[model samples]
Target: MRFRKFTSSFDTEDRLSITIDDIARPLSSIQSSFEGGKVPSEFVAPLTKFAERYGGGSFSSLFAEGKSARQKQKLVEEFGSVLYSMETEEVKNEETFLIWRDACRDIIDWGLKVDFMLDHLKQAARDFFGYMLRPSGSESSCREIIQMEEAISQLRKKLLHLEQKLGEAREDLHLRLGDDISSDSMSCILGSSWVPQSRASRGLY
Candidate 1:
């Protein structure tokens, strides 16, 4: 999400940082990037599809209602007035006001950009959640939902396998405790961290 602007611009030759990689990672090894430096042509199509359907508008205004740069400029005008007023009370603070106003303006721009990018990423995640529910029916069709389904199917198989392992946990009439995926008390329930109980000594068996 920090790298949402990567959606705004890229070429077949462009390299990516880890943040962009996380968002636009290849679906399978067939679409994977090369070691250290591979152009991101494979990801651009889906990202473009996402931007068109869900971005609301231009890359500059992706998740935001308006252009963040223009909004930042408006904020500068409003806050610069306050900085100027503060300067009037001090000893020839013209340079100081200029410095503080510029710094604050930069900070505001950064905050707005970061906020919009992160929001855009969160919205994309929500969209994909719906897409996973009904892959072919979703508007985001550029992405290969089959790949996602395969990954999820693999996970389901693993969970079923784990349930088989847990079936072996039935011993000495001890009721095996299972947990929801959230695993609220899982840490205390596992391994050396577990405190042994005295059920055998109590003659309950």
Candidate 2:
């Protein structure tokens, strides 16, 4: 099933790039950077909350267990290594860069899905919390849940709308490339050849 999904993403040049160390080291470094002072202040509360509810302890408490910041960073770094190792093992025999690219696309797709889901969930939570502020615990409380359901429904609708727009854009790119542009594929076709390496020119992806 995963392989099927991977094949559908796109062809790429990362076929020989599937080493455990290659994937694990970068991911571990990224995770470790976050655990260190690299984390932004805006992320502190939410990250701390996520770590506590899902990661067993408060951020401070978790750090406390290791005796030092370096130790805490090491723990998350190790965790990242373990996760990447598991990911690599799962697809150790992948035969193509399409598989690698597909895996990356799947991850990106899942992230977008989770982002949309979390938007609605956060809105629902706000509504629920607002309702709780009221003294009444009657049938009115149920209305909050209904409001949350409606918000989630709207979120799904917007997501579908965006997906349709993206599909149309891809189709347009295909048609345009066939007409005038002479590029290898949609990615290279849509991405201007002269685009430089900078945050300003790199499109949302």
lDDT winner among the candidates?
2
Write candidate 2's Cα lDDT for 88-112 as tens digits.
4333333323333334343334221
lDDT of 1 by residue, 1-205 (tens): 4223433322122323322113222333333222222223344344344335544532334323453555544433333233333333332312332333333334345442323333443454445444445547565554567678888999999999998878666431244553332344544445333246645446445
Q: Rate the local accuracy (lDDT) of all candidates.
A: 0.40, 0.46
Off by over 4 Å in 1: 1-73, 76-205
In TM-score terms, candidate 1 sits at: 0.19
Number of the top TM-score candidate: 2
Give the Å error, residue 161, model 2.
1.9
* Candidate 2 weakest lDDT stretch, 10 residues: 110-119
